[model samples]
Target: MAAERGRPRLARDTIVGWMVLVLFVSLLSVVIVVRESLHVSVTERANADVTQEIEEFRTFTRTGVDPETSRPFTTAERLLTVYLSRQRPGSGEVIVGYVGESGVVTTSYGAGAPDVDEYDLTRDPAVLRAAEQGTSGTLDTPAGEMRWARTVVDVRGGDDAMLLVAVFTGEGTAEADRTVRMLTLVSLGTLLLAGVISWLVAGRILRPVRQVQEAAAEITEHDLTRRITVGDDDVSGLAATFNRMLDRLEEAFRAEQRFVDDAGHELRTPITVIRGHLELMDDDPASREVTMRIVTQELDRMSRIVTDLLALAKADRPDFVRLGEEVDLPALTISLEAKVSALADRSWRLAHVAEGTARLDTQRVTQAVLQLAHNAVQHTADGDAITLSSDVVVDPDLGPALTISVADTGPGVPVAEREHIFERFAHGEPPDGRRHSGAGLGLSIVRAIAEGHGGRVDVGGTPGEGAVFTLVLPTHTPASHDHPEQT
Candidate 1:
């Protein structure tokens, strides 16, 4: 069956698009606020200028007298007419009138004046009261759509006159409106420019991220050599970290592939041997017994291979084996040493065997110990001393552990192959070019058993001084302890 799709559909480009949208929205909000502030400022300034003009006109109309003739006017109308006729064209226009003492307007700027008397100023209560009390008042005229400032002033001849100054705000209001429109357009243009720039900047920032994603997507099990180039920034750090992770993954993949290939090669050997032996039996009856013996040996070798593979697979599982009854470390070491001595004439000796106890699967522990001893014997000569020893050590960080060591007095492992000596199919050849006879699963199985028991194994030695292999197992602590006598 074809492999199911495992890649992500939303790529890095989709994320870049989202970032652009967010930046645009942020820019738009800023533009709106700035535009509104500008409009308000313009309107406020226009209103202030119009108010100042009204104030200046009121001061002139109230305090000014003719320079040539120092004569006061009889009525407010004559004074306002003189003021208007004498006013400069650029000095804003002012219209004056008078109301009775009871707040009645008896005279105005007269007829034939444009918008001078278009609206009744006295009809407005504020203006009428201002006239009665001789105070300044502002009125809104809908007909002219302008603001007029009215002040009641006493003429030089003691006649009460109402001074009306209509400050035309239509022009100023129109200017403010135009300014708002222009500001809005400018703000929108600026926002557009900013959005474009932000999009470009965001694209530049995400370029490395896109590269990383692309590089990762292109990396498959078959092709793990792809790498991403990064600039000298945070992206460089990210790229370095990613490359490190890829390095580890690649190493693991290579290790797994080697394991598979070696397993296959090892398995084929026994099958081929059995096939050859069985085929020879069909040619001669006298050789049938010899052929049967050869076939039996091949089958045994195949059985050992299958068994070791199963053990290794099981050891990989999280809960492959559980702790059993406590076993005495010293007793176990003695037994393993005796077995090694009997199997080979090598000088196998037990030393410094600590009286410690461990809760372990006894069968597996015994098997692991035997595997280590067998490896030691195979590597050393008949007369070489192979010392088997055990000790109880306390480490503050790791608590108590029972350590077992098998040291041989022969040539140690080579520097190049020392690290991988415990790996599958890593049986080291003899110094004289003689190969060891075994499935090469002994050390690997020993490692698996030690690790499965929450322990570890270490192997190291000087050249020509024979190697020392130590297995450290955690000491068992029972729930209820009655201290047993050390044997």
Candidate 2:
């Protein structure tokens, strides 16, 4: 089935791709900016070098005397030759001396000098025009772009001469190219590393979601035990929430199945009894009347069973108990004692009534207490001491609480039955060895009511003495209408 859906794009890949693309663009921008900056700096430095050389030549012409001989230079050729020979140019720099219409007189080259013809300024008319104007500027030549500055020297005894200082830009441009190449290579390597790291980190972050998907796929109506292992991140928190939802769903499904099975089992017995008696009945009026009575009794029993089942089922719903009403505990106890006193002829007496007001569903609490009272009456004879009571108690976990008890001198529940006595259809040993009459749903209803009120009902006391069934309830109202967590 998953194959039919084809392969969906994974979040990890998308995250890595976006990260790499953004990083690539940023690094590319850096490389381009740095390369341009280096180019500008190199061009400025070459122009400065050409200007300085021109200034030095002008200073030499002013002095005129040769530094070696300490005598005035006699001719333009000797003066130009002397200046060219005395100066050492920078890298990619060249100095040329020209006399009169003789064009090129003598030339000097710097380190890493290009081919002699590359910087032959005489061959370029535009350069000659600019030099004639006594201005410094750039022009393209065989050695690439060159920045040049020139000055003319006039000597009293000889032909006039021109001194040109030209600095080629090839070396600086080559260095910038090399730098850009290295930067691009490093940027590519860094991008590759970023992509690899992003893939690993994204996979780790999304692992919990994948596990949740796997767990969901494994779950069904009959199976919901799979769960994702949790962590501290937001993704892990989602997995935790999903696990909690599964827990609720599993409980709901189990309760539904149990209700169906128990309802079928309990209802079948009465149905069979009614059907058998009806089938055997003859035309005799008395026999028909007896059969009809039996059928009616069985139907009533089935109705009670179904009603109890529904009550238990509704206990799981959010609105099972309407809370937020403050009720006087003492007055509630009085009302309960008066009501349960009519259930049987047992001697009903109030042991205690708790003082104070509490927020609770009074109707539900009253029903649970009365259920305990009824159970006590069922196990005892007329005039047996059946005491009803309520009081304030301190629970280790719940803090201040209210306890209501119904104690009766009857056949106490056996030790083995106490654990599951509140379970549906669970019956204790017959009281006084007499067959109990009604369907075994009363105590279960009592338990459901107690739980709905965020309380519990438990039986204690030795066998052959009497059982004390008490409901321990919280004094404060629950925070929500949803069922409280069971202790």
Candidate 3:
């Protein structure tokens, strides 16, 4: 097992919770502000009407007189009756005056207002209390409630009197109460709406977190291929990051598996040969010399296989390609042609060489080309021709790329076997009576080298018409080169 890896846990869930809290506070503030404002305004309107009616009564007391006699009213009840007849308030207001219980004066409009008898001075606590205390007061009346003021009127000849004025508030209280009810209903409904909206938004925003968890739960060391689907939202970044982590995990697991597999497959033959030879050894001088030579040969083959496996394993590392300097394609191609010429007796041809300097690992590129060249030689004869060529070709979708090709005029690759030959420890079937040799790692090494350069190798052409193995490499410029994929 490898060391455990982890990332910073995203704070999306917390963010959503805080957002809902802020929404609640904002809506509550609006309800309180609007409710308080409406309450203050309505209360002031009711109090203003009460104060205005009291002022009207005071002014009349100082100026009233009898119309027919052209002199002051003869009685307090007369003055009260004259005032009530002249005054008319809004439908919501009722002005009732009490003339010391001698008579009552009431002006009524709405259905809810009371009759003159209902305004009896002795029956109303507001009137009684005001008269006793010589101050304005309020009381619950038949017309819901009234705010009343009292004044003592002194006549020149008649008995001193009492005058009371009150404004009935049945309609006003009902209206204010209705307004409050409506505001409360609106506030509740708005809060409910805000809650629903906030909940939906929060769910949508944190959907990616659920997806990440689902993907993570399903992934195992043997299977890291699952990835989360995401949209173009803020959480998309998190999804992409999660996907990258999965990719790393999968690559690491595969690399470990390959190391075990390759070690067992390549090391088995040498160890068996060494043990068998040592066990069958004799004391004879000639037999010992032959045994030592055979053992030495087997040991050398094991060393080569180990070195090749190490090279292939390192292909997955970031520093596998060290394209630190410029490589001249023409010079490298010429050098490769010179090198592979001695591997066989084939008529090797330097078909074409493009003159250009590119950012590349010269040794790895040469190694891949030399591998292809040697593979061509192994499959060909003395008179058969093998050609190595290089040229920069332009592609509309891929831009400019360097094409390195090795073509052989021999029993060419079969259509179905070309892909198989490039896989690790894979070998193509020999033609007719011929036998294939080596650990079958040649083409795979070439492939690893190509991918290490952020490029790829592909085989084409027809069987018996000579196959062409091409290495299509980008110029290693950032705009042209992409991060390499697994070989």
Candidate 4:
């Protein structure tokens, strides 16, 4: 069930859907605010125009009085009644009324106007203020309510009569309402169109990301050579970096495979020798002696191979153990010269001496030196001169290094074969025409030990001349002892 659910989905579509949702919400909020503001502005302008017309009419009544009879041409109620009756049009109405100082016995105009008792002019603060100040007052009137605006004008006569102008103010509100409804419809349509366009644009932008994800999903250890194809643009650089990472992984994988194969091959020979000796032991007592000796030899070889393999593996580890102690190169060379002299038939010389010192793993360093000495001896004639020398050299690139060289009067290594000579299982014919007995891991093991100590081995020779093998290690101060203990 989990595997089935892990199947890849359309990532581009998902991104586009979320983008469109956010855009729709943002655009909708802006449209709502704009529509509301436009409606309010339109209603305010319409109310101002209506109020101005009322003021003009009031001014006419105030100034147009008869000078001879000392009376206005028409009464406030009669003139307002005729004016408002003519002003009534479709979807709107107008009315006129009067309120005296005592707030009673008022006159009204227009047939559709509500009764004066029902219209609470005194209860409304704005209307009451307008009546008291003899000015105009405008109030917001919602639909389904008896709403209006009133203008109070005082007459210019001694009778203290007043003119009151009132209009239903719903016309401007209705027109604004209609405009808002139309704008809302148009905004919703725009939002829909914008959502569709945003989805398409989002899909276009996200398509490359989806393609990269798909290509990544198809990659595996067995098929890491495959790469994502991209255009020669910014996206292509990303692909190139990804491909480089894959290349490193592939190289690491191949190295691991080679290690396994080499290890198996190295172990097989010793196991076969042991098995053959054991199988022959059950047949005869005379053959058992030879078989036992053969078994012992094979066991020794196996021990050497196992030890070398462990050392190589430890060198590769990040936290490989290190035991540092001061060691004298001249003294160590003297000990090795003595041991090699006792073990071989040839004469060994110690020359070009330097009293240099180093902090090193004494036992491992001695083993590496012994291996190089043995290798030189194996390639030399029985009577050839073997020399072990020490010198302290300061190289411009490498700083101070204690150089220990073993030179033998043997056939030298060829130039083409020099690079591969340090690799495992690399053996060539010596000057004496005798080959070494073991798998060619001696030089490889020596190189590993040198590298473990943060040093290196250098080889130089000419054809038919002797080869000089030098082990270079960083120099240090000598310890105040006869000989340091092995690490």
Candidate 5:
């Protein structure tokens, strides 16, 4: 118990933890993918803008005619100066021209614009070398990061020069960063909410399991009445099944208790009879012989009672009847008449024989029929007609059924006693006004055999004329035949 209490609550917290982790991983992946895509998009757009600007410069130089003079330029300085004067850079962009060792042209636009000297590549040897090579890359300046693309141009009668176009990308990158920050905040809030919801939902789902555990803890051998309250969700099926199991357990326990009670009650009479006879026996030989006979008879009666009680107890087992055996109904019925004919001095007759085969436990069916015949013999006098019959009939709910009946020319059972005649220890009186000598479990055993075949036993006949005890069983083999028959 202490170990069980100390164990982790894996069912509750572990489920919640896994849910939160999956949500966190999924949300984080989305954020990372979005951020990377946005950053890549910003860099690509800036690169395209810079490339476009450089391409325009190359296209103008190809014309070889100055836009301002409408004539061919004589020197590279004139060409460079004329182009720089005609240029209009976009927002957050700059245009610079590096002409040999002593000439520089610069233009800037947008807010926080740096002075021309700050971007004058003439002072920076690395920048000038990179620009001269027509390279494309990023550079950190007083105006923040810039993406630059450049091209070197060699014109006749002029110093070698380079044209550089740079786009200020700090604002674009800052916008992307801001978007990621907002997404991160939102995702964190959503994760928090998801964790809370997951915790509650996990608890709700596991509540039934906890109830089953608690109910099991409270239940004992003497008390099997605890049941889980069922709901309509998927988990409710488990609770419903558990309740059904409990119901069967409770019924089995009650049946065991009743069997013990009935055995004690019934066995007391024979024990008292034997004890009384033994106590009253005298020294005379005749008296002693009579007492011994009485004692032996009582002991035999007790043995029969014990056997009947055991049969009744075993009725609830899965293998009470060995089903799936094909037996000819007509032959089985005729054989029943032959077997029961010697039970008493009554007139035993075959009334009808069904002309078909059925899968059933032949031994159990024969045993039930013989018991019915014995019952009929007890109910009627000698020369009274006892009829045995079998037939194939159709039950509306059960399809084809095979019915075997034992009918007697004796008083029929009263309507009031029919309901419980199949119950254990329940009995009906015979016509001779003599108490029955055998245990009352004969009909119960018969009913058990019928039910084991997924069928039923019923009593039907005209009142006071006769009693017809019929066993109605399915003609086809039952699905429960998968269980191996017990020896």
Candidate 6:
């Protein structure tokens, strides 16, 4: 297929070539028209000069007398001499006559023989043709073509004879030929100028395009920050779009880097614990059993950390959550209370429920709330109270919101960690001396789910008082006309 197709043309070169071709053709056309006009003017002048010379010769031959000398010519021979010497034609003109048996070459101009008798009239096709025609016409002669005319006159010596008057146009044609040569040169020069202009203009317009190519070439995995400079034209607009794409790629790269670092760090501790316990195992059944139990527990912790990281990673995907679910807030709140009751002996109660429904990922919302309930249980006493609530609120700037909060009577987060408590690997130290094996991924998971629904998570409480973790999610898409009426 590749061989079957012809080679591609470069845009700049093609355009320039076309421009030059058009210029050459146009100028050549002008040159032809101008050259033809010059030839016509030259021919007209030559024919006129020859015609007037013939008329003058005829008048003297018939009258047989010179207007200046005012005397009758006795014979054809005398008439010929008077016409040649007395009324000779201008430069580049020729005159010849034949009276009875005598022939004479009266005048000659330009190069070649001055005597006309040197060449026989009968053998010369030009002179013979002119004599046969009996009128003025162009003919090929020794001095090139002549615009000649001929007439027969009765000679006093005896019989009638021929007279000729002609002008050589070869010399007259020189000026027209020079004009045509100059025109041809001018046409070629015009074509060159046109090609140069086309090439320069194409380069100027494609400058930004070249910049985009260079910028794209410079981009790499480690350095996605390269950007192309924009200009004022449409090609510059394309460069702007190219820069924006690079920005998005750079952001995605940084995000992936952070994800890898966080995942590696979180999995390190459990892996170390598992390795240490397995290495220190003894041959005795009791020691082996204890090691197995410790290793198994660490494995469970590691599994949970991996699960949380996977969830966070998928949160950025398009189908990460079931966004089409129409969740019933009252029913969701009731189910959450019943579910969290199994976590601990804490008093799990439903504090509030919004009357209406919301559009969101129901399963994800439940998972987030469940994570918060577990966190609260981990920090609170066995008998402490925990309240789960779901209510929708309307704000001028934020629109309608589905706010679900979990409040517990536990060791609340300290004032210092409030801002970053929702960050991955950010957690409050357990109040009790006994340590809890949480991956510090619960709140971050909760925040991810909330933000996935175009919302956020916030905490509210004093340092000593029980803290309330609120998951405030926007239930409605900003431009949603999918559900015209409130659900």
- The C-alpha TM-scores of every prediction are 0.61, 0.86, 0.70, 0.61, 0.89, 0.64
Q: What is the per-residue lDDT of model 3 for residues 379-417, given as tens digits with 9 covering 90 to 100?
A: 787879998899988745446778899999867788878
CA-lDDT, candidates in order:
0.65, 0.83, 0.74, 0.64, 0.81, 0.75
Model 1 scores worst on lDDT over the 10 consecutive residues at 1-10
- Predictions: Cα RMSD each: 8.8, 3.7, 6.4, 8.8, 3.0, 8.4
The list of candidate 1 runs beyond 4 A from truth reads 1-145, 151-160, 174-182, 230-249, 283-289, 309-349, 355-368, 377-386, 392-403, 408-434, 444-468, 472-487
lDDT for each residue of candidate 4 in 122-232, tens digit (9 for 90 to 100): 356666565566555555433223334455555433223344445453545466667767866877787778667866765555444555566567777677676666556
Per-residue lDDT over 1-487 for candidate 5, one digit per residue giving the tens place of the 0 to 100 score: 4454322257778988999999999999999999999989888888888898889889888886976678777666777787887777765677788777666755545453455666544465666666656588887766578788888788778786678787877777788999999999999999999989988888787777777777777889899989999988898787788899999999899889988998999999999999998888899999999999889999998998898888878787778888755788878888888999989999888878898898888888888888889888888888999998889999775679998899998887877778777877777754444566677888988988888888889898876889999989888756874345566
Displacement of residue 28 (Cα, Å) in model 5 is: 2.7
Tens-digit lDDT track of model 1 for 165-213: 5444444445556766776677667666765675676666666666667
lDDT of 1: 0.65
Q: Decide which is better by lDDT, 1 or 4.
A: 1
Tell me the lDDT of candidate 3: 0.74
Candidate 3 structure, TM-score to reference: 0.70
TM-score of 1: 0.61
Q: How well does model 4 score by local distance difference test?
A: 0.64
Better of 4 and 6 by TM-score: 6
Instruction: Indicate the residue-level lDDT of 318 in model 4.
Output: 34
* Deviating ranges (above 4 Å) for candidate 6: 1-194, 429-436, 479-487
The CA lDDT at 383 in model 2 is: 96
